[model samples]
Target chain A: GESVGLHLPTLSVQEGDNSIINCAYSNSASDYFIWYKQESGKGPQFIIDIRSNMDKRQGQRVTVLLNKTVKHLSLQIAATQPGDSAVYFCAGRPNSGGYQKVTFGTGTKLQVIP
Target chain B: DAGITQSPRYKITETGRQVTLMCHQTWSHSYMFWYRQDLGHGLRLIYYSAAADITDKGEVPDGYVVSRSKTENFPLTLESATRSQTSVYFCASSSLAGGLHEQFFGPGTRLTVL
Candidate 1:
């Protein structure tokens, strides 16, 4: 299975605190990584994306860190809110523009506990 | 902002029955994708299209058929629905640009098989 997996099945964080969700991918050839947030009964929405060329990328209140050496990827959300309580998925894109092969990981349910 | 719309926000079907989920996007992004989200298993790509009449299989293309006669329309059909096919289906579209393709996803269509 050319798929990525998360280190934690679920993560619980207090409101106003930062949250970190880790993922490990087996494909060393993968060049792109993306983070997605999915609410209950909703689709996964794009969060932040990182390229193999860079180790980290930041968004509005989110950051994606990629460690190619260990095939590790992590998403950090600042000031976690109840709205952020959803499953976070990490996906990997094989090489360049061919996105049809983007494979997602077994999500990590993020619970922003108030 | 009519970005993407999914029909039959929820569907229930029996085994061996045929079901089609419709997805429409106003962006005309030139790249449309279908994915299924299950417990533990995040968003898995079922099929994708680069443009109308140009479709490609993704990681989980089995038991699924897709057609892209119009760039804004991408429909996923389960030739024979099975209990295993019960999951939330999402449709997403991205720009044709090569780098940093940020995909916008639909709300998702939940399907249950009995």
Candidate 2:
């Protein structure tokens, strides 16, 4: 069973500071990865994604880094804010899937301290 | 209204009762997915549809059934709800345009089976 796992279950960071969340995946056949932000009582929202062909991708104030050699993925958020407090999930999509099935990590709860 | 939406934002039922969660997307993206979110399990895919009348099971498809009569609707039915089935369910839609496969998720439906 290929799985995506997170190193920490919860992360605390101060406002205006950068936040880094890490994820590890077991599926080397995964072709792409996505990061999702899920607030309490809401569904997960797409944050950023990177294809396996690329090592890193940036968007807005966020960056996604993928290390295929180490089977690691990370998300960095700049200037963490109160609104950014939420559970972040990392998902991997295998290239062999037919319907774009994705495997999601348990998630890391990001807590921003004011 | 232009994105995905789930009905009965919250639901409660007793064990052995049958329940259905509705998912509709306006994008007609050609791909829809149903997932259940638990405390430590994250989002586990239950079922997915590639197009109208085309469907397949995902990672955790047990105790659940799905149908795709049309492109916009993909419903998940629990034949006999159990206490373990209590969790938040999310519906997402994605397109293969640009080969990104980035999914857009609906708000979510919270179900509690006692």
Candidate 3:
């Protein structure tokens, strides 16, 4: 089945540096996209989300970019801090009549070096 | 005060045994979801509920049963557990107010079936 996937399994960045995580999704019918962060022993925490109607959305020090033509999505974190180190996952929700189904990517581990 | 929680942070069960994982949320979200996270699979939805008494199967729902008897509780039961069922399970909740929105996740439960 076609699903969402990440480009890299792990990424390392120096503190205060910018970090970028990439994701690819196969479902064009998807209308909603979300990014989540998971610490070592916790559930995924919601970071930011973007809708297919827009190409980009920004939150506190975080930005999400969506490219419908390539079926790609990316998350950028500015001034990466040690506390920002975690596993990041991208989820896509396909538009199915009334209710939508969400699919998650494998995830990318972000390591911030202080 | 208002958050989602799961019981039995860790469990070890034998194959063919019956086990149930419990999820609770203080917020009265209209939608609740169950997802399993495996090594390579990331996170896959097992089941979801729009409201009390309304449940639906997801990507990998086989061998898993879910019920939302109450708005704040959603439980997942494995009638006959298998070694392959050993994985981390997470419970999430969201309000379906605006089509689809960000989901709040609970601390996962690690289940090891031997």
Best candidate per DockQ, number? 3
**Cα distance off (Å), candidate 1, residue A92:** 1.1
Candidate 1 docking: what grade? medium
Runs off by more than 4 Å, candidate 2: B96-101
DockQ for each of the predicted structures, in order?
0.64, 0.63, 0.65
Q: What lDDT is reached at residue B41 by model 2?
A: 89
Fnat of model 3, as a fraction: 0.67
Judging by TM-score against the true structure, name the best candidate.
3
TM-score of candidate 1 versus the correct structure, residues matched by position: 0.92
lDDT of 3 by residue, B7-92 (tens): 89999999999999999999899999999999988698899899999999887999999998899999999999999999999999
Instruction: Summarize candidate 2's per-residue lDDT along B1-114 as a digit string, tens digits.
Output: 568999979999999999999999998788889989998886988898888998988888999999999899999999999999999999989884624337788999999999
Among the numbered candidates, top lDDT falls to 3
Give lDDT tens digits, candidate 2, residues A1-114. 468999999999999999999999998999889899999888888899998999999999999999999999999999999999999989888987654367889999999999
Off by over 4 Å in 1: B98-100
Model 1: pairs clashing at backbone N, Cα or C within 3 Å: none
